[model samples]
Target: MALLDYWVLAAYMLGIVLIGVFYAKRNRSAQDMFAAGGQAPWWVSGLSGFMTMFSAGTFVVWGGIAYKYGMVAVSINLCYGIAALAAGYFVAGRWKTMGVDTPAEYIELRFGKSVVQLYTWAMLVYRIVGTGVALYALSIILVALMPLPEGNPFRDPNTGNLAVEWAILAFGLVVIIYTMAGGLWAVLMTDVLQFIVLNLSVLFVLVFMLQAIGGVGTFIEQAPAQFFAPVSEGYSLYFLMGWVCIHFFMVGADWAFAQRFISVPSAKEARKSAYLFGILYLVSPLVWLMPPMLYRVIDPSADPEQAYIAACLSVLPAGLVGLLIAAMFSATASLASSQLNVFAGVFTENFYRPLMERRGGSGNLVTVGRWITLLIGLLLIAVAISIPYLGGAEKVIVSVTSLMVGPLFAPTVWGIFSRRLSARAVWSCVLLTFAIGGAFKWLLSLPADGSISPSTLAWLTKHSAVIELGIGILVPLSVLALFTFVIDRNGTPGWIPDRSKNATSNAGAMASDLPARVVAVAMGLCALLLMLIALISHERQLEIGLFALVTSGISAAIYLLGTRTKIAPEFQRAL
Candidate 1:
């Protein structure tokens, strides 16, 4: 990266930290810090959830797959959309309808405190490692961009970039700082910022890439026959179907996503938020994933993992490349911060608050929450630095999310509807399912090394993703079904709420407009920065200026649209 790019990247990071600091003052209590105090509009919560689902995995892992395996990468991502849409329809409104402040609260309510404790610790460990894998992915991109001299102490000879350890340390610290400072409100606003930046930046990448490749139709005509196939060995049609089910359990019951569902005012708003998230995912993947696929044509020998960013660095002018990298940071930061906030909330509400002999004020508990956030952040950093030794980011991500989601979350999701599922049965079924899945996915699979003869079970090894997923989804639910039907079935359904009341928000008119106006001004500033750089350099001035003009136009449109939603002055005064 050029000196200008470094400056741009630094400014973006600093801006993110400042956003956390800005939101910090508004967080007077743990509820405000962790729950948005239920003031977030549906769109804000929805956009935040959408951005939280992104990280460097979207680029490095899926983009690499796109470069190598054709359309399968997009297919894998589309699974998230399909799953989220299902979540919107089946479970998003139910979260609000249950009237729970936190998913853990619901867990404790239905299954008792022991189950909540078990679920909390288990998921905290699970999600922290997942976040670590994401940070590891981002570190790969960063280390690639910042190359080092051969003899430099931090230099990595293999890639001639900074060492992964140092990259992980530096990036992890930045995420931790912002998460500790900003809390969940900061997470929501920054996510919205990332949503805009990522979309606008990728559109620019698509434009440039298409221009370079002549056209989509021309590229398609000249491409290999298999370039557009939607299935591959590891990502077959069965895997995709199973993938949808895994994410359904994930989005519907996972604390981070469920937090988004309950952060809104009403059940209707919660469903609306999830629908918007699903809709965005449905449309955005093809556009965003195209750069890497097109890059496969541009340079077939290019390293697949770096293909997405490489396409941008190769095609985009300097300032915009920096902007795109910053946008990538926004993606990783959004996910990391959201996870941190959710985990902190779980610790505070489920464990720390309950155990206190004399409960401090909510503000004091908020301080305790910050401390817990720091502790988890430290562990996440430790895990990220160790990711290379643990068989790389891709393996860890696929193995964990696929092999564990069903066994861990399915029972929890089912408990929302079934009263016959006792705590003992839940534990028995989840642990038993894990043992079965571990055997299928890990213990019984061919060893990672050139191990016990390749011909022993090549087909089983080839299709392990689908197998693990099938067991993960089917095992726990099947056991639970048996327990409910064949074993015991004589209780009222657990405290199910029949209807959700419309909530009167404590936030007045100005507060209602906060998210939109903040996002608009952020967009305008980013646009101004791009135009200024293009003006100073006088290279690709037209493209950059036009991009800026369109971006600023969107900014104005959002701000004006926000004005329409503000309550009339008298109404605000009445409140």
Candidate 2:
């Protein structure tokens, strides 16, 4: 049965790659490859952005986090949603207008080529390492889901462990081939399909868990109060600081999420996407978490990875487990495909393309990007194989990403909002954020091995990641503000002039005719209402069925109208 599941996964992955190859012809120009001609509908781009950010690891890892840490995990997710909204409202216009192929290009525009070069290197390092970690998690999930038969050649000879590494390697190779062939067009288009598969899988599993656990009442009865609490475990000042750091990371440095700005047809659509995603993203996590929660109810001592697989397998009927695991693999592919594509984009636009342009032939930029994808994929496979040996894979992954986010977000935000700030200020802020944020995060590490003193843990239980993210955002902004004020007491100089011009030209700024403020307010209100529902549902303050109905109704109405208003143009064009 498990082998059958693995075979199905391989077949499904191959089908996705073939689709990419078929669409490669449509991506003739670099613009088409990079931004899908900025033609994708608001909902498509919006959902893709949401789904891409909803990496497969989010469910498995976050579910585990929720199982272990309780509401703190949800707090972190809420922080991410806010970060996404902030980006949509404020920063995305400049990015969309710049018409740049990659985020590192923004660095070049704001500062000098040297700063751009430095940022490019930094981004490559951060993304590649992060991708490796993501790949490792994906592989671990697969190994857990589809166990290889004993004495099979696919099992490692030395330890008799299943060689999921090879399966992961094959999956990576297929993704790289398709991504390199089709670029962003293929990536975004396939992302649409992948998103559907993932969401259906999520919905299916959630329904199964709810039913198997004897509905919401039984599930809640079996679980601890903290299991449903989103703000309990992360309520401390220190943890609050951590949440701030995390928020900055998501809002600022996450080029993976930020890249959506370039894919949308206009800024109106971008914000619409953000608003829609804020709600859609809320439900997406439940797919991965609910099952684990159900599993934990069954076997309290089951490790997180084990619990995730077990819940998925047990809740899903026998034949469906294979299809569901393949769906999980599709989720993995969706994530890996995007990351590898972005890494390639960054390398080509920031590093190889420039170097090749200076020297002569730019033809090989694509070739080099393909090679980079292949190399990154292999390194990730190595990382995946070694995750089992790591003392604390999850903590290490989260901490490393958290520490690196400060440098990325600080300079980008400073450059965008404050035009007069000199390149020197930008450089200074980057160094300072790296130093301060990194130091603060390391020094105030949260129970390095997930163990905290009861009082300290109790404090964390009350505060959460949002509060930590607040500190992270404030500290960097404070540093930037201090330097900006001192350097140019009058205010930011070159930033505003360029920004004004960019805003006028950028597609996102074309919303000048709409009731911008009204729409913005409406979006905010809807987001707030949904968030309240999420929190209320968590606390079980209202009837579960009623709350779900209200939440779904509001979400559906907003999405339908928002789709017509913001997405219809692109849809018409595509048709």
Candidate 3:
């Protein structure tokens, strides 16, 4: 990288820190630190949600998949939009209506403190591993794209080069500092900026790549046969279906995404934010995957995961290359920051605060939260460094997350929707799923060349994580349903508390604010402008134009209706 490139990257990193420092004073309490004081505009929360979900893995693993497998990769990713829409319709509003600061708090409210503690511990582990994997993936890309200085001794003797480890530690520290300083407010605000930068970088790369590849027609002509196939030998229709199911459960139940729902200003805004997230999922993939897909045709035998970085280095100018690198870093940082914030919330709210008898003042709680955030960041750095010992970063990440979260999904969903499911039943189901899924995952992780039987090895190897995820969901739900019928025959009468009365009182005291409405309108206009740019530059004019028009119209309507109407009493009570 050039000196100018370094300067651009440094400026980007500094800018993120400044944003966090600017928001630091606003987080005067635990709620503000964890949930942005529940004052985030719908659009800000929506953009954050989108960025949180769009981790660095999108550019690395998913881009690689697109490079190698073609449209099938895109087809699978579209499941994200489906999941977002489902959450908007079914989960987001309810989460906001409950008015809890963290998902663990909501879980505790519905179930009990024991279950809440269990969930928090599980999430702490999951977030550490998940964030570490993201950091590791981005670090690998950075190491490949940005050369190290001469005679640098950072390289590990055993690993050949420890550039990945150094990169992880360096960037991870930056993320930790900013996240600890500003909390959720900083995360959301910086996410908005990162989203803009990353999308622009994607557009920039896509334009240059298409030109380099001799336009869309030549690019398509040079693509392999499977480039157009939605499903094939390894990735079958069953895999796609399983992937869709996993995403639906994961998106709806995952605490990181749920945090966004709870942090939005109102239940209505939560739902609207989800809709906006879905819109981004629908539109952004076109640009995100294009360069990598084109790179497949350019160098069929290259490491597929490096396609995006390779494209950037090959096509972009020096300063722009740095910007692209910053964008990649932004993806990693946004995701890591969100996870760190959520981790702090879970540890402090569900475990520390309650166990200590709520002894601390708000400032003390926030201080503790910041400390926990810093600790989690350090743990993630260690995890990232250790990732080189793991065979495949992407595979390990997917498998571990699926194994951990798969069991939690059914219980979380049922707990929210079904009064018939007793706490005992939920606990039993969770324990059973953990035992079974963990064993299955462990077996799957074992070396195929070992003493295991051929048939067993084949079953484990052929099924993939998606299929295991399906089993994880199905078995737990099945067990829970059976227990619900036999053990809780009468159901837990009035299982849901009468929060309505309290909610109504809270609602009466608060009024719908106008700033959120204005932000929503502004966001809609930005989306329309993005779509207009797409319509003019890309081949799919009709599709892009329609998307822009619809987004603009809906945004305008939302603003008009928001200004005229009062906040729903139930939603206000939730606040």
Top lDDT hit: 1
Compare the candidates by TM-score and give the number of the best one.
Answer: 1
C-alpha RMSD for every candidate: 3.1, 9.1, 6.0
Worst 10 residues of 2 by lDDT: 509-518
Pairwise TM-score winner, candidates 2 and 3: 3
lDDT of 1 by residue, 1-575 (tens): 87677777787778777888888887787777787877777888889989988997778888888899888888889988888888999889888767567788888888888888788878877887777888888887887788887899999888898988887787777777777887888889889988888888898899888989999887798676788999987888999999899999998888889999887766777888888888888888988999999998889899888899999987787777678878888788888888888888888887888778456533377788889889888888898887767765565577678768887788788887777788876787778877887776654455746665566567677777787788888887788898788775775555555352323332331235677788888888888888887786546788889988988999999888677657464432322
Clashes of each: 0, 27, 0
Residue pairs in clash, model 1:
none
User: Local distance difference test, per candidate?
Assistant: 0.81, 0.60, 0.75
Model 2 stretches with alpha carbons more than 4 Å out: 69-71, 145-151, 158-161, 234-245, 364-368, 386-391, 437-471, 490-492, 495-575
Between candidates 2 and 3, which one is better according to lDDT?
3
Q: How high a TM-score does candidate 2 get?
A: 0.78
Q: How far out, in Å, is residue 126 in model 2? A: 1.9
Per-residue lDDT tens digits for candidate 3, residues 486-550, read: 77768664246455753663353333344346435544744555464454443445544555566
Quote the lDDT for 175 in model 1: 79
